[model samples]
Each structure stands twice: as C-alpha cells, then as structure tokens.
Target: MLNCHDATFLLSQRLERDLSVTERANLRLHVTICRGCTNFERQLPTLGKAARAFASHDPGAEDSSS
Candidate 1:
C-alpha cells in the first residue's frame, strides 16, 4: 500500500543497505502489488552491480589519451 514516492525512497535506501528487515519486508509487499515498484526492484541488482563495478575501478587507472 506504499505510495510510489515512499517505495522509491525505501528502494534507494535499500540499495545503500540502510533498510532494516521490517523495511525490506514492507517494500516486498508493496512491490508485489505494484508493477512500477516491481520494475524498480528489478533494476536494483543491475544498478548495484554497476555501482560496485564503478567503485572497484581504480580512479588513477584513467588515462588521458587522444
């Protein structure tokens, strides 16, 4: 029964690993009935993977080349 805004907010926090078990359960319940939220949830793992990849890359490894 969570609104889109709240679901998205919780999802963002969940991505940051800041959500508690209760929050996660609530989000799960919300996504189950909401296609938009379900789609949003599906994107999280990909986003998380991209974030981890970005974080793992060495900043100094970038080279300025023509």
Candidate 2:
C-alpha cells in the first residue's frame, strides 16, 4: 500500500522518467483506491503544460506588445 506522499512523489517522478514495473503497478493500485491522488495524477498533464509555458515565456515578448 502506498501512502499519499509516496504516491504523489511517484506520480511526479513519472513525468520526468520511466517508473519500474513494480512502481507502475503500485501507483496504479494506489490511484484506484485514492481519489485525491487520482485527481492529482489527472492534473499532471495540465500542470506540465503550464510549467513548460511558464519556462518558455520571455518577458521581452510581453514588452514587445507595448
């Protein structure tokens, strides 16, 4: 059984690298039983996109509009 902290950590790590077979299995099982973690997992993609957008944003680009 995975705790919420461990589960969330795994969920975030998954986006950065591949999880081992056991890790995937454990996370899958944890997500099935934990609605909070499940929602967090679902939001990962949107969060990733937002992070990329923020990272790629240039302050100069905004200034160009003025």
State the lDDT of candidate 2 residue by residue for 27-64, as single tens digits: 99999999999999999999999999999999897798
TM-score of each: 0.59, 0.81
**Candidate 1 ranges beyond 4 A from true positions:** 12-26, 64-66
Q: Cα deviation of 18 in candidate 1 (Å)?
A: 8.8
RMSD (Å) of each candidate, 1 decimal = 3.1, 1.7
Model 2 vs. true fold: TM: 0.81
Candidate 1 per-residue C-alpha lDDT over 1-66 given as tens digits, one digit per residue, 9 for 90 to 100? 678889988988875677888887888888889999889878988988898899999876676452
Clash tally, candidates in order: 0, 0
Clashing residue pairs for model 1: none
Question: Model 1, poorest ten-residue lDDT window?
Answer: 57-66
Local error of candidate 2 at residue 13 (angstroms): 1.4
35 Cα displacement, candidate 2 (Å): 0.5
Question: Model 2 lDDT vs. the true structure?
Answer: 0.95
